[model samples]
Target: MQSLGLDVLFKGTNFLRLLEGLWVSVRISLISVVISILLGLVAGVLMTSKNIVLKAAFRVYLEIVRIMPQMVLLFIVYFGTTRVFGWNLDAEASAVIVFVFWGVAEMGDLVRGALISIPKIQYESAEALGLTKQQTYLYVILPQTVRRLIPLSINLVTRMIKTTSLVLMIGIVEVLKVGQQIIEANRRTSPNAAFGVFAVVFLLYFLICWPVSRLAGYLEKRWAA
Candidate 1:
């Protein structure tokens, strides 16, 4: 124990601070995920429209999200925007904004794929049965879309949670940042503090994400049947 420097976690509220930092990450992720779901639904519907201009715009947005790294997006939103526009956005807010922007694009693509996967024959069958547009959606199309969507969207939540680690670059003081601070503070007395602190951080992240991933898997199987 002494050799590993795990004891440093017991020092003067250090562990508590780590938990607090983790909560900040979780809070940001939850808020962003909620906003992403709402907006992604709208963006997804727009993506399926027959209008060429609208499809082109969404395609461009999706391409930008895919090509640009999330870390770069964070820097642009948190650092560049303030320097360029003289805006005073807080760090947490900036993290949330960057994540939502990314999340919406990804989620929108998922939605588009789910919507398009339903065969045209299904729509034709619904029309033959005298189902109106809304009725067709509510009864036939939406039910299947939701089954495919829920598991994928739940997985996206875990992705967002893990990605929150990047927010530390923008000075959010989330879990990874807290671990760094602890290791730095204990460098002299606990030279191996980095190993123990980081190990714990990894455990915390696993504890949070494993169950979510499992739930997504279970839902995917359950719904597919």
Candidate 2:
């Protein structure tokens, strides 16, 4: 029995390999997202801090992260850091580190934007109602900020998933890397395998990212509505 392309996609071992690769991607993305959100929130708040030192520090951090390309960051962490420090770092670990660093900076900027976008009158009204600093943040400011933050954070998640592809450069056997290996292994038997395998890789990424994109859009609309 000849195997069709769909058969390759669904056969037991192939399915397991694909799932394993996907699980690695998901694990990295999920952990990176959590770290990014927590640290980003803190940095974001600091970016808006009244203290000049805090704000300036956060601004510098944001600028550096935003300007540094992810591939260069990965290389620095995985190669330069290890060579300079005499430390060993695996590709997966380095990928997660790079993504979290980038994601945190991006999320912090998004959060800073949201926080600043809040009207000053809202703060005044909170104070007029006898709300203390903590109380205002807890009751008045955070609720509104959360509504604005969710969709933006979803957008960040989508970006992180896509950037995981760059992990291949650092030798992580992610889906794209695995696909490349499969195509290379079959190059002699299937000369056109490169295009076919890469198409599958593209579709896999689209499937992963599209739903998150839709979710972000839906939240924005429902909130706006």
Candidate 3:
């Protein structure tokens, strides 16, 4: 019997393929998070407005996003759109769309909460100082809001990175999918291949997420101090 080793990862271009898959996951997550942040900021600010129609519209959107499961949303974008609209959207694109929708809803709520948490007196004081709305937000409110936002947003980025694994369901050859492929290819020769491959995948995820988590914690402490 051949000795069990992690030779499978190093064989031919297997390891390179895994790295490529990991890069795909990272790329999708980064793009989705950036888009989500922009959309969330707009939605959150709109949500706080006094316009009843605007608030109601965004409220419905928030409720729909919160109520639906992400996997369901993924299927809807990936499968449902293709069947219903005859759109040939690729798996990675669908994954990004679903994640962006989810991220926007979550980040919007965070922004809204941060915005609302500011004491009413702060707004009054800014007005008293003859600060225009734009100046007030730019100089006073937004800075404070961003301090409260950074830690939470960083946590969301980690979530986005981890959640990219779900894209495998729709056939994106992400890291997790590549790991599974490696395990299958060596299933007969190396019985322990699955364990090693998955272990590496776990480590990769941990390595990517751990520092972001630590940064979030550090920022929280620094902000509080």
**Model 1 Cα lDDT, one tens digit per residue, 1-225:** 888778999999999999998999899999999999889988987899999999999999999999999999999998899899999889899999999999999889888899999999999999999999989988998788878999999989999999999998888899999999999999999999999999999999988899989999999888887
Off by over 4 Å in 2: 1-12
- lDDT string, candidate 3, 1-225, tens digits: 134447788888988998898999999999999999999887777778999998888888889898998888999999999899999998888999999999998899899999998899999999999999989888888789889998999999998999898888788899999999998988888878887788888888888899989999999999995
lDDT of 2 at 170: 84
| Model 1, position 63: C-alpha lDDT score | 95
Q: Candidates sorted by TM-score, descending order?
A: 1, 3, 2
For residue 143, what is the lDDT in candidate 2?
80
- Show model 3 residue runs off by greater than 4 Å: 1-5
Report the lDDT of model 2 for residue 197. 64
Q: Which scores greater on lDDT, model 2 or model 3? A: 3
Q: Which scores higher on lDDT, 1 or 2?
A: 1
lDDT of model number 3? 0.89
TM-score of every candidate: 0.95, 0.91, 0.94
Residue pairs in collision within model 3: none
User: Taking the tens digit of each residue's C-alpha lDDT, what string does model 2 give over 1-225?
Assistant: 122233344434665676577767777898999999988887787788899888788778888897999999999999998899978998888888999889888888888899999999999999999999999988988788878999999989988888787887888778877777676665666667667667777888889889998999998999984
The clash count of every prediction, one per candidate, is 0, 0, 0
